[model samples]
Target: MILVSGCTGSLGDTRTNDSTDDPTTGNPTTGNPTTVDPRACEDGTVRPGRAPLRRLTRFEYNNTVRDLFGDTTDPAFSLPSEDVGNGFGNDADTLSVSSLLAEQLSTVAEGVAQRATATPDALARLAPCASNVSPEGEEACARTIVERIAPLAYRRPLAAGEADELLALYSVGRTDASFDVGIATVIEALLQSPDFLYRVEWGTSDPEHPELRRPTGDEMATRLSYLFWGTTPDEELRMAAQAGELSTKEGVRAQAERMLEDPRARKTIRFFFDNLLPISNLADLERNAEAFPTFSRQIGALMREETQRFLEHEIFEGTGTWASVLTAPYSFMNGPLAAFYGVSGVTGDEFQQVQLDTTQRLGLLTQAGLMAGTTHSNNTNPVVRGSFVLQKLMCQKIPLPMGDILERVKPPDPYSGATARERYSQHSQDEVCRTCHQYLDPVGFTFENYDAVGLFRTTENDVTIDASGSLPGTPGTVSNATELVQKLAESEEVHDCFATRWAEYGYGLTLRGEDTCTKQAITTAFKASGYNVKQLLIELTQTDAFHYISVASQE
Candidate 1:
């Protein structure tokens, strides 16, 4: 029931070690690659493509509150747990609306709506009504609310009838209560409405081109907001839709650029990174007290603060690139985290950046936050850590192990000299276990020198922790952390993985077989534009997929 969506680790485990040659489809015996028909598009046939119902992600909900009413209350903190697809919470297919979540949403909607209506800031957001009366006052008030909140909520202006319905809701509330309470009640309804919660988009059968139907400009606004901003559309985006520019390629690009400059865009990126990494200790990391008794609650706060500072310095303050993320020698630390990282100059109660010698540490490969999340209550999981790199960075999938394979689980002797790796290596010999364990353990062995939380250590048991291992699909057999970082940082697969993750997030679904084209375009555009995050945002908003909806199949 408590589905955790945004943990930055791999869920891959090996089962039934099997690698068959890529299946040949064209001429089974000719050895020629299968070729797809080129003219199929012109033929009258249904084509495969991506479709999604846009909605607010948990992170997007939190950020939107801050922007709309300066409220950072985290509704998603306890909103019904979300399922992760393709290693993210933004996957629309994995998202579900249940009675539990519905009830929670109702409560949140009530709280947020009341807060927005009462705050002077919220009233300031509303446009001045020409006059406060029955239909006329209602029309102006509804339009103003539509113009302001709808952009961030529904991502488009409500149709005149939809506006009238909203006005009617206002009327009921006004008749029963004060005008302010009535209007707030109407806002509550919009917040709770399915239209607001689930971003519904679909295909319209084109009369002239029956083979091609697409999402309208209004639908595209939701598509763009959820994908890039991870939240509702703002006034600017809704206005763009009204002007009909958002429907065109040029308009999409312009709006994306404008949105990047808006402060809220940063929140979108931060929330995603949080979900992708799931470093819980950024708020409060649970640590083993008996082993590292020196570790205090305050150190947990400092640890995450230092990392955030490092990201700010490198990404926004300096250059945001795959390389800089791993190799930047500086990190933040106060008295406690500084002591943990083994630095001496940092004073008590103050966080400042410090450069480390490479011998002491590497990139995220040896970071405490990442290490802590992957470790157990007692030990580090190399298999889990190895899987994280493969799935999160490389974008390769690891299959889940069958239930039968796990029941045979055996733990090494508690007092034995065997290290976690030596114990893990035993699985490689088991005919059933070896196939998958082989992939995870070797990668884990490379981090042997670091304990569960990434603190450097000389040995595990009696064996020296050897931090060297080869990657599965890399050229030449290389060893050591430096080579691993180099291979991962510059990989096309890594960049492609990032592209896939972002596009899936932007479109609010898993980037799968149908999304090949959108993914490629986003990757290409991002590269051509110097890997600017903002430019990629623009590309997603303008793409054909952003404006298309699917027709329901008959049962």
Candidate 2:
């Protein structure tokens, strides 16, 4: 069967007219207020949106095999890389498997299963009863193995006939082969099973709203594990689901709080920030080695690591606020990075938190990695930098420039004597280019203090750089990148945008008009929590969007 059959019943449509609540005021557009809490919908009804069936991304699949089989080969690397829709590979809409991907999945599963059951010791670990089973007890031992691994592979207790189906596969393989071969067959089948690959959520009936349904406790456990740990639910979480502890919001919150303290949560945090920013792109960052003699691909990799370390520390160990993320005056750096940034005292390759030069550096925007990633190989590009700030940081949609316009205009000349700001002044010279460049170049010019490799500079080609620029909503202008980021750290729009991004990443869907109330609830709590990064994650689990599902209409 094709992978398309895996998603047969998981399709869904969002409820558009479920609530008339004003997102800002929390009052009905045509009726009186229903409650005092501003975070609720106007009718005080929980209207959840739809969540499609999500197949495991390559990252999740690798993690699953590592956890499930204790195999560290990263077999999913053989599978196709995922489409990075909506800035994340996990977006459910783009996770459909093509025939090629299906074939790869089967191939990878066979390899993983063969490796997992390669020896008698491994088979014993897979099913403890396998080590000493007699010929008479072979079927019984196979049943034992099926009962043990199927629940984990499916991520929930098997349905009535599920174990029988898996045992049937085991029987066919064991007809002439040994028990290990039979177990291998079962492993391969489990890996390719729809229930194993897809997070299939069939919501329970909600009497208060017949149209709406809440995810079952086991399904909730699956959701939490995947979001927080990026893998299958552990035995403890599964036990909690079986015990009905995951049926309540408080229980889920308790579990999320516990999960965030794990090292696995750090990886999830890194994935989110790595995708949200341009950090991961640094691996292939092209630079003119003749000009930047000290820079190399290794340095780019370290820069990516530096940002990830800072993000993990700030969210879990530091102030854990959006303010800190944008304006923290310290960053983690090893000896090489410290020397690269002209700082001293840090030694060895072990990264440690080091204070930054406040006069020149501040937080993520001024970091060398991002600064270098956004600029050109030999010179700074204000337009690209400004577009990154506008489109990514502020969530402003900068429409694509016409193809003819792109062909006619070129980047500022790096070989010129003028500073980056002066060279880029040509963008505003053309009326057609000025339309978008006016918005882009200004924000980008603020980073003129940092050069191509993000080195602090006062002059380029013997000309004093002008690093002053204006933010869109903020008044007046900021003198440099530090001031620009400081203003952004306090912006309501930026804060709400951060919340919107997390909600989208966690729920695996892009936000739409119907998601207003859900977004408002998350934003309100985020603001209430002073934008605490960890607390914002906890708030995400408590939203209606996380707890309920709106099934597809019967057309």
**Top-lDDT candidate index:** 2
What's the alpha carbon RMSD for model 1?
A: 5.9
| TM-score of each model, paired residue for residue | 0.82, 0.90
Q: State the lDDT of candidate 2 residue by residue for 113-196, as single tens digits.
A: 898888777778788878777889889988888898898988888889988998999988888898878889999999998998
RMSD (Å) per prediction: 5.9, 7.3
Against the hidden true structure, what lDDT does model 1 obtain? 0.61
Number of backbone collisions per candidate, in order? 13, 0
Candidate 2 structure lDDT: 0.80
